[model samples]
Target: MKWITHLEGGPKRVNHAAVIVGHKIYTFGGYCTGENSREYTSMDVHVLNTITFRWMKHPISDLNYYENDDILPFKRYGHTAVVYKDKVYIWGGRNDRSSCSNLFCFNTTWHCWTATKTSGDIPLARDGHTAVVWKNYMYIFGGFEEESDSFTNAVFSLNLETMRWTYIQTTGKIHAYIID
Candidate 1:
């Protein structure tokens, strides 16, 4: 196996989120370990070219530059990302203090993150969740809540075209975990 090594490129992070669109891999926010036992989350974005094995740091642009009525995703990890159409959607990741329930979308063509405005039943703030995009819809399930010290089995669906969130009821309780 030929291992790819490019230490001088991309974020030096752990628990970060990455998604492959076409042949390029885009990576976002994660945590960094510091000396003296310290850790902090990152908010940078990077693009990696698989064919050429090169990296291009695509730092997030200024929030004010975008004309939109949405907030930016916080610097976090343990979040889930899925590529639907040309946009990469990032949802539900936690930081040091607490978890987040916000949803953000990054347009591959535009190369920007848009804090998505969602309606209906938004899922609870969580981490360690799994997400998959299927037929213009994103399905999310199972994560953890640090505040309550609990695990979730609830499933959620997000309509990528309409930008809506819906809760899918399921019978049973099963504690699930996804390590990175």
Candidate 2:
């Protein structure tokens, strides 16, 4: 494969999650260093059209911006995101203070965010994890546990159809590593 340089209009970020859907790549939640030498976590959603090689920020509604609005996700970094069907599922990221266990979904077709309600054995909130989708399941594997102040080797899965989480027991020895 060859690497090609493209236009540079997108936001400069680190530890963000990027998922490809159709011909575009969608990036969410990461921190960027500001001019004052402070790190600011972002909640903006940016999209890159592969063919056009252009970047556009998708305006997402702010939390509690309207009456009876759904809870929006916080600005975070080191999150994991995966696409299941037309929606991009985001989970497990941390801000300056702490990590999160919430799941947020972005409908690619509608361009809207939905705070997903989950059930069953949900894993502890974490950051720097990896997530992938396979056969209607989103598998989350290994991240830093803020409460324990250590990295974890745990594995969990969420069923897309049922929205239920289940801890998966493995047999082999798998080392845990941070994904960002």
> Against the hidden true structure, what lDDT does model 2 obtain?
0.84
Instruction: Write down the RMSD of candidate 1 (Cα, Å).
Output: 4.3
The best candidate by TM-score is: 2
lDDT of 1 by residue, 1-180 (tens): 886675556667788889999999998777777622122323567888988888888756334323333556666778988999888999988877778887888899988777788998988899998999899899999899776789977799999899899999898766669999
Name every residue pair that clashes in candidate 1: none
lDDT by candidate, in order shown: 0.79, 0.84
Which pairs clash in the backbone of model 2? none
lDDT of 2 by residue, 1-180 (tens): 876976788978899999999999999878777522122333678999999999988877233324423556767889999999999999999888778898988899998778899999999999999999999999999999888989988999999999999999988866669999
lDDT of 1: 0.79
The residue-level lDDT of candidate 1 at 52 comes to 82
Q: Poorest 10 consecutive residues of model 1 by lDDT?
A: 34-43
